[model samples]
Target: MARWPLVPATDAPKNRDPEPPEGEAFPVTSTGLASEQPLRSAAFRWFLAGQSISLAGSAMSPVALAFGVLEVTDSAAWLSAVTTAALVPMVATLLLGGGISDRYRRDIVLRLTSLGAGLTQVGVAILLLTHQHPALLLPLSALNGIFQGLTTPALRGIVSNLAAGRGLQQASSLVASARNATRILGPTTAGLLTASVGGGWAIAADAASFLLAAAFFARMSLPNLPPRTENGPTMLGELREGWSYFSSKPWIWTVTFAFGVFNALNMGVWQILGPVIANETIGAEGWGLVLSARGVGSLLASVVMVKLTVRRPMVPALSSMTLGAVPLILLGVGATTLWLAAAAFVAGVVSEFFTVVWETVWYTHVPERMLSRVGAHDEFWSFVPIPIGQLSTPVLAAAFGTAAVAVTGGGVAAVAMLMPLLVPSLRRIEIKRGGD
Candidate 1:
């Protein structure tokens, strides 16, 4: 692994135009069309339209799947078992997906994956509707995961492909806002569909959404990507290449590692201990309100980020994340429901700001050729520790008490999240307009 310089500077190649002074807005092109014209691009519009449609259906799957499983087995353990089957494959193949995405046209990768995923979902829906053998669920679920694993990295990279250069921020913010809106709409629609019709129908709806997304991808044009340079490369070789790039970049791996630790602590405490605390302190209904408020905050953040500009994006990226622990602190201290909810809402707002800035910076800074692979590694590391956190938090809470656990995790998470700021490579990454 390469060590970073102590001074704040980028490890990547210097831009032709020097970075503007700290706190100055990024140097936009004279035309400003890179930022302005992305929305007008037919390709970007189609990409957004496809994602919007797919996300809406994908969102509904969680509720529908849960209920669908219940209709078959009526066991929470089975629910966990089947869902884990899906997740394992998805996580296992993420890096491979990234490599493939980089090797081919992203639009083609997305199209195939979307079609595969849609067909798998449709199969799962049929099995569920017909009340097939419960044993089939796990295998079907794993098949679903396989498609998801193949899809995700390709999907993540496509935004950069569709909206390059200065338009990235605006493109990202628009997609982010659409995704946030769907988070509310998807589940609501699923709930109504599940109640009025059946979980099977709701799942079928999700499958249909995937098919529509695939159709959109099939029709849309993508930028001409470079031909694959490494002929007859092995999968392992390509993966190693991606990993080499990922680990060599201090900013990339440092932030990724920070997220891993923060998510471990934060997710563990939140998912495992949160509901228990709410039961005792705020009551489940109040907790629901708090969660709803958080979602609303996320929606509002997407809107705010559309107009927001950051010169040194990492400043706000890391700074915004520090606020995430506030709600945990309040929860641990036994704050009232309204207070806790208010804190959660603020945390959600800041988290979205971090998200928008982080994505913008990643695409802005990383080499385009390696974007998918680097993104996959970034996601893999960040996600790998979540289960560990979720599993261990309970044991720790049992020993130290929930309040102590929550406080300790929140404090630790806050410190870990901010640690990347000390790294020179990360601290000075600039997001500027012009030049691909």
Candidate 2:
């Protein structure tokens, strides 16, 4: 968020303001101030309020959607199809979305996408309420994905802008905490709504949240960006530029690649086999409790991170990620529910810790102008392996048995997380203090 100028002030365009106006939401600065608090900024407070509400709604919609699908046709295959419809478009459009964010006002991009997403959700609610054909969900889900892709990159950039230089870590931590807390509340809310009013009402609530968040975004006052010159790079050229910058940074690309491997293996085992193992040992209710424990742990970590600062973050960040493999290992070994919950809790804490630190590092080091495009690349690569894991895990578990697959996947994920440490550049990265 440090608008640490990429070029000197003397070389900046005359139209550009070196600092934010007196009443702007994010006051620009060259370096972070440790005493600054994110919540004190009216802009950040509004942003957080909107994001927290939207995240809660987002978390609820999935549960409602799943139940709605099952009610219509108790076919797991149809559910998978609906999920895939959303995933494919989201992954496919990420880079293009990132490029668009870089060329425009990130807040405006976010506002438009949120509006689109809300409208799509409204359509989904209508379809569910009408008991329409399940096939209709495919198009609706695909539209949701397109909106999601367009929104994500801009989200990262906007958070940085909201807090700017001084309160980035606190901002990231607060946002993450809201997300973690919502993960616990959202599903429970969805269950209640699905039982009483039906899935359509729950989804309708999600649509309202999106619309409200869009309104908050519209009200934010951000510094004006320089107008895009007619001779500026084309979208394709801009994408190439983003890729060039992303690939050129060893710390950036290597950590992202490592996360790709880690996410693929970890998601495969934890998402697919964890439930299977839980069903065999613990009941469905117990499995839910285990997940709830993890969410609680993540929330605690985010609170801790508000005051915690790491000078050299990557070392600890990567180191703690190894904890992510613990729950898988416990599940593979047929641990009791209590044991599994304990492992999951610890894993969640470390995982959230890594997330907070990672965002802080990016906000501190990356140039604000290119943050969205670069983040898009980072998100794109990290997400690309998810489907591979989701698809292959069940097949592997069937062939090798769930226990063996879970254990092997856990081992592989741990190694994948640690492998980035081997890169000297990654290991040596430190927070850029005082605009270094």
Candidate 3:
């Protein structure tokens, strides 16, 4: 694991050249279209498009992996263990993973990581075909987690690099939109595919998505990305430096703390609680519909995200944050009401609007070279609480009752999220054209 050098004082790379006039959607030269839309380059678009399948496959994973584990082992502990096996490695290896991203061309890392994770899916699918133990998916997932840990930071860092200047926000919007769209289709598509063809085959489709991603990434002619820092720290040192940078910025820490809580609780509610909520109150079909509603909200939000620059910093964002609690709060209360479910969907859409704004904030503010490592730091801490929520949700539901648990949880989220608003670092922060 190569470490990071001290962050050089170089400015975020800027592109000032006028893009050749563009008529068609495709760029005629390698320099890219007008600077205003540097991100519209054929390479970046294809890169994003190619990653779409992979994201869809990621969305597909939870269903196949969870249900498969349940089929093989009847205990909730077994299910929890499988997820932990995957998640722990993702966060634990994240900085080293980021360093790897910083070292190689992002496209290369994307290609290898996608192919590697895809192969794990392929292996899991094959074993399922043979009716092998579902626990096998755990190791497969763990390996895939490793690859994803690598890919995530590299991909975003490269995006920051590729999408210089005005297009960064636009590029970020497209990425969010792409992710939202995939979330919409991925599960339903996976569910239908699994129902018709079995989980094994559904997983095989996930495997195939990686092949497409690899192909697309391999063909991209990205700029050479030599490391920015000279001889610096070893890999562990680099990882530490990343943490220093992350901690040094109150803006970074402030936003990360907010999301860490949000993702941890929200993810568990979705992964473990949502299906259970549906099963108890509604049905699988109802679950699909509600989840799809959220997806639709996310999709629509992402599309309009390009123009949603936050002129009013944390104050407005804070108000929205308070409001964002509605859907999840609604989820707790609204499970029995269809209208409430619709409200839940609306909440998801509205919440993501703020999420996109904040994400670009971090991206712009952080140094390009440290993007991956800093990103990994955010990811690591943000997700650390998720497994806690995951393992505990089942127990909480068992003890407190699901509905009560949900209502309480929602209340906690709203209150807990508000604290950051008072923190001077977060309150003092301002949004601008850059991701830093």
In every candidate, how many clashes are there? 0, 0, 12
* Per-residue error (Å), model 2, residue 331: 0.9
Candidate 2 or 1, higher TM-score: 2
On residues 1-436, what C-alpha lDDT tens digit does candidate 3 reach at each position?
2222223345422211121111101121223321336455777777787877778888888776666566556668887887778777877777787877755667788888888988888897888767777667678878977887888788767666556554666777788888888887787787787777777787788888987888888877666744556654567766766776788766567667776777666766666777777776678877767767777887888888777666445656655666555555666774464765586677667777776766665555565567788887777778788878877888988998777766777777676667677765555444554433
lDDT of 1 by residue, 1-436 (tens): 2233222455533311233343223332221113345788777787888989988988899999999889878889988988889988998988998999877788888888889889989998998899887678888789889888888888777776666566777788888888888887888899899899888899999999999999998877665554545455666776777897788767779899999998898889887898999999889899888887887888899888877777778977787788888887777888898998898888888888888888888666665556788899988899899989988989998899999999988899899888888877677677775552
Please give the range of 10 consecutive residues that has the lowest summed lDDT in model 2: 21-30
| Candidate 2 global TM-score | 0.91
User: Which candidate do you rate higher for TM-score, 1 or 3?
Assistant: 1
Error of 3 at 373 (Å): 0.8
Q: Write the per-residue lDDT of candidate 2 for residues 1-436, one digit (tens) a residue.
A: 3222243678854423343221122233322312346787777787788888889989998899899888787889998998889989999989999888878877789789989999999998999899888899999999999999998898877776777554788889999999999999999999999999998889999999999989987776566677778777788987887887788767789889998988898888888888888888998989998999999999999999987877788888888888889888888999888998998999999999999988887776666667788999999999999889988999988899999988888888888888888877666556533343
Which number leads on TM-score?
2
Please list the Cα RMSD from the true structure of every candidate, rounded to 1 decimal place. Answer: 4.7, 5.2, 7.1
The CA lDDT of each predicted structure is 0.80, 0.82, 0.69
lDDT accuracy of residue 51 in candidate 1: 89
Cα RMSD for candidate 2? 5.2
How close is every model to the real structure, measured as TM-score? 0.89, 0.91, 0.84
| Candidates by lDDT, descending order | 2, 1, 3
Off by over 4 Å in 2: 1-35, 432-436
User: 33, model 2: CA deviation in Å?
Assistant: 15
Residue 410 shift from truth in candidate 2, angstroms:
0.4
